[model samples]
Target: MKQGTIHNKDRFLNKVADRLNRKRITEEVQLPTWSKQPQYEVFDGLSQDELLDQFVLQCDAIHTNVIVTEADKLNDDFDKVIQDMGGGSIVHWDDPRFESFGLDSALKKQQEQGTDVHCWNYQLGEANIKKAEQANIGITFSDMTLTESGTVVLFSDKGKGRSVSLLPQRYVAIIPKSTLVPRMTQAAEKIHEIAKEQGRMPSCINFISGPSNSADIELRLVVGVHGPVQATYIVVDDK
Candidate 1:
């Protein structure tokens, strides 16, 4: 123990902490008042429909396409988003959404409706790797994360993999607003905690704050050198 340490400090400290943790403190701690918002604001207190509108406006500011709608509207929004992005036909798919959500019927219908949203569904063993590779635009929900800088961390288990965020020309992510926080660093710390508890490292830990970009060219900047040229984040209000 350190010089200032007490022998029974763990239990005592916990008891003190419990006493200090009142309902008001908990509520205020979760949703803090920002001193000010930047010209580009981080959203709060918006409904799902409102959030969708806000998300779309921000996307337009950066020339990124926005798509929203649960599995029910996936076919429409999914196809519309791709077409707006200037992509032709669904040349491929990553298939993560289908197995996790069984969105095959919806996805297949879009394919038939000239979405060109491809899905072989050949049952080529127990892997969905190839489907994601040829996809024009991959869609999935994020595991709840940052609001500032528009970052979303899609844990590989439930949502799309890190590759889907990178390999495609454009990427779209759906974030439930209830999970939003102020910035990127907070998301990192939370992921670290989840990582420690799991006793195994996540296969991929992407800290995406915006579109894929680089300025390492010949004295000029460029985007999507190694990944998507553009990125879009859709925040949905579940409350």
Candidate 2:
């Protein structure tokens, strides 16, 4: 029996599978990109430092303990925050800053101490979906920020995943001052620059304004509708 020649029974199964595949793809295409539903808050002041201060204040107001520290202090602060949040897990990319920021070692220790520290260097959407579906906190990095609108832009490149931003019920993004731009328009231009240099555009560029929110029927406002209940911007101190 030549393997290249399909039997009648196999052909019938293949046709059924093909129809199923088309139906699955059709459902995916019909699914919506979720509406514009975020409780956006623009912190006052213009500088990165100012925005960071306001972010800390907002976190404090929401009763999430603030953990501001030096690069070396990330471990202690991170551990405390994760523990306070009920100790789920932390995930990272292949980026070298995990060590530079001193999070990799601390998180590993936490995992060994009965916490869950899961690391995957690829497929961010799947990773995020997993962590979001199970973990309490999902940690990742960001490419830039918009100080004017108080927006964080997580560039979905080789390592940084967009799901790392969207899926997690609680998202903590590590962004330094060097990547802070002033506006959303600039974010698109930066994307264009990267596209021109890389010969193609990346698959996703996330501009997160704030946690998910909505004003539905009767104009009643509600928060945390589709995404995380909390989104905190942890600005690592360089000094």
Best by TM-score: 2
C-alpha RMSD values across all candidates: 10.4, 11.1
In the range 105-161, model 2's lDDT, one tens digit per residue, is 877798789876666557644655586566666777667766555567776656665
lDDT by residue for model 1 over 1-239, one digit each (tens)? Answer: 12343698666766777888932232334667788646334454555455455545555644455555464555556556666767643433354545444456656676676665644343542234454566666565666555444556666532334555656567767665666655555567778888688765565667665576566767666767776677666554445
Residue 83 accuracy (lDDT) in model 1: 62
CA lDDT, every model vs. true structure? 0.57, 0.64
Candidate 2: pairs in clash: none
The alpha-carbon deviation from the true structure for residue 210 of candidate 1, after best TM-score superposition, in angstroms, is 3.3
Candidate 2 off by > 4 Å: 1-68, 123-128
lDDT agreement of model 2 with the native: 0.64
